[model samples]
Structures are given as C-alpha cells and as structure tokens.
Target chain A: MITRVDHIGIACRDLAASIAFYERTYGFSVFHQEVNEQQGVKEAMLRINGTDDGGSTYLQLLEPLHAESPIAKFLERNGEGVHHVAFGTADVVAETEAITGTGVRALYEQPRHGTFGSSINFLHPKDCQGILTELVQSPVHE
Target chain B: MITRVDHIGIACRDLAASIAFYERTYGFSVFHQEVNEQQGVKEAMLRINGTDDGGSTYLQLLEPLHAESPIAKFLERNGEGVHHVAFGTADVVAETEAITGTGVRALYEQPRHGTFGSSINFLHPKDCQGILTELVQSPVHE
Candidate 1:
C-alpha cells in the first residue's frame, strides 16, 4: 500500500530557524512552503537531495500557528523534535480502508487536505506501536 | 554532505513482531537482518519500496540485545517508537569533521562500524533539535 517514505514531519518551535539550520548545516534547500490552516501549521518542505523525480523525500518543518494547534501541543509535550513519519501511497483512502479493515484505526473518517495539495490521514499511535504514522497521497495533476 | 535519508531507526520491544507488522500491513520485505554486537541490537532493514538503485530508503527495526543496550534505554523512556534519523553520506569522517567544525559535537571521535558494513557516527541530539541524528557511510568495494 505504501510506496516510499514520503517525508519526515518535525515539530519545530521556530520554523525559520529550523529551516536555516538544515540549510546551513546540510546544504538542503526549501522546495515548497505554505501554511495549512486546517492542520494549524506553517510548514516548509526541504528537499533532502537534488532529485526532481517527485520520489525524493523531504524534511517537513512545522510551526504551530496558534497555541491550540496540534503542533503546539506536540511541542509543549515533547519539545521540538520529530513529530511523525509519513509513508507515500498512491491512494491514501484505499490504503486507510485496507489498514482499518484489519482493525487499525484511522484518525479521519474521510481523507483531509494536506501539504502540497495531498490527501492525508493518520493512524492511531497506539495501533502503530507508539509512533504517529501518516499516509500521504500526492495530488493528481489532471 | 548528506546524499539521502539512509534510514529511520525504530526501537522495538520485539523485533520479530515489529518486522511482522510492517510486512503484513505494508507489504514491506526485510532486505537484511543482523545482530550487531557492538550496537547491542538485533536489527532488520525493511525496504520501503521496490527501488533498489542504492538510494532506496529503509525502515530499520532495532531490538535491544540486553538491558544495558542503548535501544533498551530508549525503549524505557520513549517506548516502542522512532529512535533516530540517519543521513547517508559519502565520507562519514570528513562529514563529521565538517559538521563539528561548526561547533556541533559528535558522539564519537571516529567513525564506528555500523550495520551492513557501513561506518557511522552520531551528532549530539542537543545540537540537532532534540532529534538523534546519525551519519552513515556505505562501505566501498575495492
């Protein structure tokens, strides 16, 4: 159901600083940046390497827009660090249905809009051995 | 200096069970399995996708071999979840020196043996935004 590691989500106290750190330290550059009000995060996607095949992975730096944002809550509890691991899928809805059919719970009843116009949903961390897992389906160009 | 995400290291209480979970749920197959005495863990590398161009990413499941193992310590505090993010590099020694020249501390003075005959070293988590970061250099065939 899953393709590759889509991206690694990191909860950052300061998005700009985190982006700068990765850029200066590792020579990674931001590929995309946007604010997702629904997810309550201002995020920047840093290309890990120079691959434009659309299969390259990214480091997603997320900064909460408000105190009540999920990223804020994660930062409050865990401090600034890796938040979730995302798996790439061709069809997130189908993958969610297949996994949930096996007794794993999906966080959303329907697919939700995600970064880069993707569809995304989370699996319950309890069912995923305490790791927050996200399935991401890239936006269709048609 | 990093080329790509080498792998995501996950600390698991039961290596077999974790490996089974990925295989059954995601159709990911184990590419390699080994007991690294120096690292004090039994680990299995699961290929995240079918791409084998030496750039394919992996999910590394690690279970501690003994109580004193670092994986055991991480499991004690964080439970079964992601442990660290590893970046692939061409020369771990040179990368370490370059990174440390900027005042970031390395966990070791020299590159140490890693899984699959790779040389590896770690950057102090405090310097890495609370995320344990590893640099891995693939062995060269001469």
Candidate 2:
C-alpha cells in the first residue's frame, strides 16, 4: 500500500545555486547534503514547512557531477526540474506489479537500493502519462 | 511556514478515466470532486489509503473542460503528466511575496481561487527549473 508523498526530486545543473534559490526564496532549510559517487551527483535535501514530525519528508535536489550520470542525461533532455516524485509504500514490488499490470512500464523489475537506505523502483513517465513515479520503502531508523 | 508536502497535482486528459485508473490500480478512493470553471478544469480528488483528515492529501486529476483552459494549453505543450506539486501554506500571500521577490517569474500576480475552495498562485516552471510550483492556501470547507 502506498501512503503519503515522500519527496519530490528535482534535478539541477548546479546544486548549490538551486539550493540558494530555494532557501532564499521559499524559506526552505537545508537538512543534509551528500555526494553519491556511483550516481556521480551531489544532492541537498531541503525541509519545507508543514511537517508534523520534525519534517521527516523533504525535497531532494540533485546536481550531476559527470556527463554520464542519469541526472545529467535528464537535465540535458528535460532540463533542470522535477525528476520524480517518491511515494512511501509498504511493498514496492507489489506496487510495481499492480502498476505494471495496468500496462504501465516499470523501469525496474524489482526494488533497488534508494538514497538514504530505502528500497525504491521507478515507473517510466511514458506509462505514467509523462510524470515519472517512484515507489520507495521508507527506511526504518533504529 | 509551510512544512509538509500537501498534494501533487497531475493534469490528465480525462479525469474520469484517470480516477478509475488510480482507484482500480492503486486502490485509491475518490473523496472529493469539483469543477473550477474559472480554471477550466474538472478535478477529482482521490485519497491514498482512505485518509480523510487531509493529512495525506489525494492525487488531484485535472481535466480541462474548455479549449482555452490553462490546463488544455499545458497538455498541448507538455502532454499528459504531473502539472504541479502544491505545498500547503498557512499564508499563501506571504509565501507568494517571498517567492516572487527572489526574481523568479510567478504565473499569477496574486493568489487565485482553486478547487476545493483553496487560494492558489502558480510559479512559472521556467523559474522553478521546469517543475511547476503552486502555493496552496488551507482548504475552506463548505
């Protein structure tokens, strides 16, 4: 079962610049920052207002560090913007099955390791009517 | 201060078909439906996991009812997909002012009426890195 919105991912060419824009303009505060060497990108998470439990959810901005990163490709094709919206789900595999059963293409046949230690899968935007949907299993903090 | 994510708006060609697809595929239920003639859209709100307290906001499918509707133009240009991600705000006017003062383009000079009796103002996707951002005021119950 899928639940509330987890976060909206935005891909940008310059992570620092975009973060400055969001923070200065929207009052969004940076929660954390990291560089994913495998994805070849640096990311910053921003906490927006309205979080009930210390703002457990936030938006992620990704800046590709290399030309071969998928984020780079997405930025090149679609430009800097929303990459995907992540939804917290109980069973990503089941949700993928459910969505794929409707003839929507699932980018991943099974859930893969997601950022912040979550299990996630991607559904192609073509099948999702142009909005890339990502299903993520929220990480349980010990 | 806006904190948590409120809801994501998806622009669909057919609201009924989209609603049926979401319900049948994802087990979401339609909680509310309304047509904002001024915005030129018939919107159907589907609750995720049947939460009705507005904690987990539903997916809003927008179907443009007129040729000149802004949604219709969006569809024609961008095709069917996620239109905007609305962040719930306690003071939309203040948020709008803050957002616009950043030198980013806002689609509306002032907050306009939105479906479900909420006030909303749109920030241009060009300014927001291709992701349309909407500042939505708290819902007014009838």
The best candidate in terms of TM-score: 1
Q: For candidate 2, what is the lDDT? A: 0.76
User: Which candidate tops DockQ?
Assistant: 1
Residues A1-142 of candidate 1 have per-residue lDDT tens digits of: 7777888999999999998888877778999999999999999999774222356678999999999999999999999888999988888999999999877899999999998899999999899878899999987411
Give the Å error, residue A19, model 1.
Answer: 0.8
**TM-score of A-chain in each prediction?**
0.94, 0.85
DockQ for every prediction shown? 0.54, 0.49
Clashes of each: 0, 8
Q: lDDT tens digits, residues B31-80, model 1?
A: 99999999999999997742223565789999999999999999999899
Docking class of 2: acceptable
Pairs that collide in candidate 1 are none
lDDT of 2 by residue, B1-142 (tens): 5644667788899887788777766677888899898889999887543222235455789999998998999899878877888877767888888777778777887789986788888888888877788878866521
What DockQ does model 1 achieve? 0.54
Q: Across residues A18-119, which tens digit of lDDT does each residue of candidate 2 receive?
A: 988888777788987888786678999886533222225569899998999999999888788788877767678888888888788888766777777778
Which window of 10 residues has the lowest lDDT sum in candidate 1 chain B?
B47-56
In model 1, which runs have C-alpha deviations exceeding 4 angstroms?
Answer: A50-54, A140-142, B50-53, B140-142
Candidate that scores best on lDDT: 1
